[model samples]
Target chain A: MSGLVVERATPLCQLQDAGRFGVRHLGVTQGGALDWVAMGWANWLLGNPLGAPVVEVALGGLRLVCQRDACLALAGADLQARLDDQPLAPWRHFAVRRGQVLDFIGPRLGARTYLAAPGGFLAPAVLGSCATVVREGLGGLAGGGRPLQAGDTLDWRGAAPVAREMPAALRPDLAAPARLDLVVGAQIGGFDSRSLFDAFNADWTLDTRGDRMGVRLQGPVLDYRGEGLVSEGIPPGAVQVPPDGQPFVLLNDRQTIGGYPRLGALTLLAQARLAQCVPGERLRLRARDADSAQREHRRYLERWRQV
Target chain B: MNPRIEVVAMDALMLRLFDRIEEDNLPWLLAARQRIVEAFGAALLDLVPSYTTLMLHYDVTRLDLAEARRRLAAALDGLRVPEDDGGARHTLPVWYDPRVGPELTRLAERGGLEPADVIRLHSERDYRVFALGFAPGFAFMGLVDPRLAAPRLDTPRQRVAAGSVGIAERQTAAYPLVSPGGWNLIGRTPARLFDRQRDGYSLLRPGDRVRFEAIDHATFLRLGGDDTPLAPTGRAAA
Candidate 1:
């Protein structure tokens, strides 16, 4: 195991890989880091596997002390982090000597942050993943769904150099406003043209009710005229409009089945962008077909293998 | 002739199980499941069979979806839900009294039957376990006597305790865990339907047949049954 001890960690922090998969029929939702792009880049900076585990920090305000000298990489949102009062930024690599305190006061940009160690964190894989799902009581260090509480120590078995920097081209841009590309679901037509127009043209505000399950978008009331549809398999990025006429884009932790009339799933690439938006963030929708959505999804997946 | 097959995306292909569920469609549903499992190995991420369709989730990164559809079409072109594999019939026990079953009175009235009559009619039907979804161990069983068919609550409860036995439309189900739900809760089952520690996480799977056996409070307490006995296991597919 690498020489590193966590003197302090917070509940909002936990080890995450890409996600847990292949068990949705068992009703298990895929749980992983929200900002998948950042998670990949953090791992890439350390020359580790693209899916290596990392600490997913949400809304910052986390502190950890390196008991043994260790090197680490930080990526994703710039959470205004510091090393024992020495200021540090994200999308770069850094190190802390023994007894040095690493603190993430808060996010400077995006809502979530990713911190990567050399070989990923040491945690047991529950059902083929270490991503934590507090609702399901699965994944994480204890292998029972729970977040990293203060005083918890995260340990990893792999080690690398003190620090390394990711190239400018490799870092993700957090300044760009989130624009989600949606593949107008087949039911898009079932919705009156008026609803469709608002779906793509109007800017929606991210509702605070959002969680891993789904994000409720506050915008023009979306209407889909149809007899209530039968319950069917729900996919990630599914934009379901409940009776209230609001659209909710289901995310990684969403249930496997639903019955509400769905506008359709947002492309996978759009899902990644949606993952980072903070509450009240303005989002514009762009319509595309399956062929175009698939192409963009393919291009996004190719980024990890490009290394 | 095969029903229309559509490509939802690169990783998912939709197999119209049927336009609507009917007696004849069960055979097609079962056979298609086996064919997909045999044909698609690592490429198949999930096989989601719903009321009238099968959504196959695959790895778009590794294999193209059109190819998957072709392969799946070839296997399930002409199939049906096979004869039951001679599985044992599980008789679950339940108590459907008003104190224990808050929704019993409403459901009984809707069915035009007394509470006991509704309970007896519900327990008589041997319902096939459709596919499990919504939540872990949440079993979506079938159309109770049509007379018992009820609409889902207009307002969903903030939290439906685990093992709550509920009926909605023609379907009856048990909630394995506490979550917001709209099902018309008729009773509560103390029997753990989904205990992660138990060897069987879910007792019902898709295609399994289940029957409920009505029991009085005395027997219910002896069996440690809550208002409804919802000892669900993950091993079975419903």
Candidate 2:
């Protein structure tokens, strides 16, 4: 069987797909690739489904040796990847010979990098997804919520397509400062006008206290006039404002429900972009409506199909 | 009833039935969820029902925001009392031992009652499952008897044992796994609230009713409550 043997692995490396859905009612969170667009593009290079499982490497400290000759695709963060001491850039598919060693040194452009096999890394589906959620202890190569480790073999059966590089025009510009689009929620009215102005116009720095679960924004203190909110279902990208006044954008692995007042939620594309931002990166939030956000997402998905 | 509909994200919308949780609102919310599932079918990704809100997660690739909103509004218009009244009622066996819950005495003192009386007040009422959240299969059930409505610990415990029953104000919940929590621990249950091997995984769900039944330590052990400490740091009582 065509496979790759893990040589050196980091705790951040885990198998991911679109995500575990329809299970949030059971208190299960949706865990998947933080940079979903990159994951999809990686699989697309191999002619696999957009949501196929792939290895999500964060900050890059993983190394693998090819056990068989196979074609694989790498997308998302330019993790300074190298194959047998030769420099390898992301957003392209390539072939690896048996015994060749692939190393992911560290991130250069973005935080998370996605590596895709032809048919996606083999993993048993748990709760309708192979999205690894360590907190929940579900979905991983071992059929349990564990990150990839040395000695673990990753095998995929799908046939590899002709090697190709992602078009330069199509590649997402990760170098630019991100302006995340947020669709103002009903609670937006409850925020003071000054706070609301600061929320959108102010430059917010990504706090060091960030993880897959949430990214805190350190900026102007948002004065919320609303009384204590009843705990409600918190969707991915919801910008929840805690008592401290700092807003945290909840991510894929966030808890299903929370009591923090929310200004709004980020657009899906913005969330994908936010995942690439490192700690202390300066970002601004742009308020958008539901219709435009939907259109933007549809356009993004359409581009994937066209590719 | 017109719900306050707002965009949760690009592909999800939150429908608020009421400002506060009410028994009557649950039926309509449950009915609305069923109608949405029936109407949207594959387009609907997930439905997260919480206190007074039902968030509908949909696939933007399959349906546009306008269409989804329209379908959701239509579904709400057709909402009626569910024939089954949500899910089944569950009777969970709980061990109300002070040895298992260290905070039981303190919680009882705050409520101006003995630990045994506090346990009695807790187990007597059939609490409605308001939501399942904070952790996997961690069911948040409600309206604890006023006498047993103790506040959460001032400082949260580093690790709460799995199946530990806790109360915070009006809400009571059983911890599905060993996790950090602030709720005042009162008892423990041997029941596996969350099991990955099980088909449904979560033993309790939203809209389900739960009644706690007092059990002896012997019965708790027989029901698979091992005496082994659950804390990873070995802080749990032996």
List TM-score (chain A only) for every prediction. Answer: 0.93, 0.97
Model 1 per-residue lDDT tens digits across residues A1-307: 3344555566667778888877766667777887778887787777777788888987787788787777788887778889988888887777779788888887678877888887888888877899988788778888887878765678776766434556687666768988888766556667888988899899999999987788999999987787667677786678899999999988877887778887777777778788778888899988877766676678876776664
After superposition, the stretches of candidate 1 with alpha carbons farther than 4 Å from their true spots are A1-12, A161-164, B85-88, B109-112, B197-200, B216-238
DockQ of model 2, rounded to 2 decimals: 0.80
Clashes of each: 27, 0
Accuracy of chain B in candidate 2 (TM-score): 0.93
lDDT of 2: 0.87
Model 2, stretches more than 4 Å misplaced? B82-84, B229-238
iRMSD for every model: 2.0, 1.0
Candidate 1 shows a clash count of: 27
Q: What TM-score quantifies how close candidate 2 is to the native fold?
A: 0.96
Pairs that collide in candidate 2 are none
In Å, residue B220's CA in model 2 sits off its true spot by 1.0
